[model samples]
Target: MEDESGIFARESAYLERYVQLGIASGRVISVSFPAAPEDDAEPDHPLLERVVAYLEGERDDFEDVTVALTVPTAHRTVLEATRAIPYGEQVSVERLARTAGLDADSDDDRNVVRDALASNPAPLLIPDHRVRDGPSAAPPEVEQRLRSLEGL
Candidate 1:
């Protein structure tokens, strides 16, 4: 039987989103990202629900199943920080979530990462952690270089 680990998987398309755009003088800004398609493939990942239920002490049907998530290279600092810690001492998941502006404490985030590790998802396990951190961490010279290369 294939260990569920080390397989590539796509991010869940069922996750919800909220965005706003166009606010003047403290009114607000509204933004429209693409809508998740209704016909998108359903999530087979139950880890999020299971983790929540476990944390809440409401889960009576506990069976081990893995879930997967994708970590984009755009958030590399989190990955590097995570990698710095030995697995036994690693607190990368929470740190990564915080760096990515996601709720690190959320079961959803945790499960997503766990799943990704199990499945060996791309980008999540790729060697591009530097890209993950945002612009503030970029040095002035590097930033100038990146900008110079942008339209080329």
Candidate 2:
């Protein structure tokens, strides 16, 4: 298992539009597009620069980003499977469950996967958006841009 820390720091940027990065315990906790700026706004940092580069398709810098999330044990499998999804690709919940060694056919197990994805704390870093049935925390345009970058 990887130590879920020191991967990225919380940073904000106006890449394409205003976005917020939430990091803690040395790992990214969330990525969101805020409608307004918060009071403690800081200037763009290296992490944001890397994220911008990634979104622009200039580089795959975000691939190295790590995230820290504290969900129930059952959700861990779902998150782990989500993390393994390659950039520019999508997979169904059943496929994800199977990849995570869970019983894909079980309604209860599938629900766990779906719920975990819906509640994903880290979006871009863990990339729950890559899951076909997962909720996307990022703006639809941003998600579309990412997919376009991959020619998906």
Candidate 3:
């Protein structure tokens, strides 16, 4: 877990929405602060709570949460396989491609995995940091931090 005093979130009305996570320094990717909290009793704020909990060191798999991913078919396949990566575990891009039903030994297949992760719409939800042997949605430092947090 990391210190969450700087934590912030932008919630969505839809139950499942894409989120970009940057855990290092607690900088919420593409987030904005209102300078003052709103008083609205929005019922769809569970994502905020779950993200806060995850930052606070909870071992949340996040499988319970859904996301609306709109990507190319190849990217979608790779991202969905990435999403199935269990907490504290990792796999190579070739392996991930294989899991996604692509030929594991094909360079093109592996590149697709890399490109898909680079464009991942839901970082934390997809856990792209777990892709050990290729490009990740997380920045280098952020990826290291996330892996450390997962006890890898």
> TM-score of each candidate?
0.23, 0.79, 0.71
Q: Candidate 2 lDDT, tens digit per residue, 11-98?
A: 3333356666665654677767665545665545566776766665664626666666788987878888888888778998899889
Give one digit per residue, the lDDT tens place, for model 3 in 1-152: 23322333443222122222323333232222232333532323445678656756888888865555678999999988998999999998888999999998988888898999988866767788898887766556656767877877
Return the lDDT, model 3, position 72. Answer: 92
Pairs that collide in candidate 2 are 6-26
CA lDDT of each candidate?
Answer: 0.31, 0.68, 0.67
The list of candidate 3 runs beyond 4 A from truth reads 1-44
**Model 2 off-target regions past 4 Å?**
1-16, 139-141
TM value for model 2:
0.79
- Evaluate model 1: give its TM-score: 0.23
RMSD (CA, Å), each prediction: 18.3, 4.1, 9.6
- TM-score ranking from best candidate downward: 2, 3, 1
> Cα miss at 96, model 2 (Å)?
0.4
Comparing 1 and 2 by TM-score, which wins? 2
Query: What does the lDDT read for residue 45 in candidate 2?
Result: 56
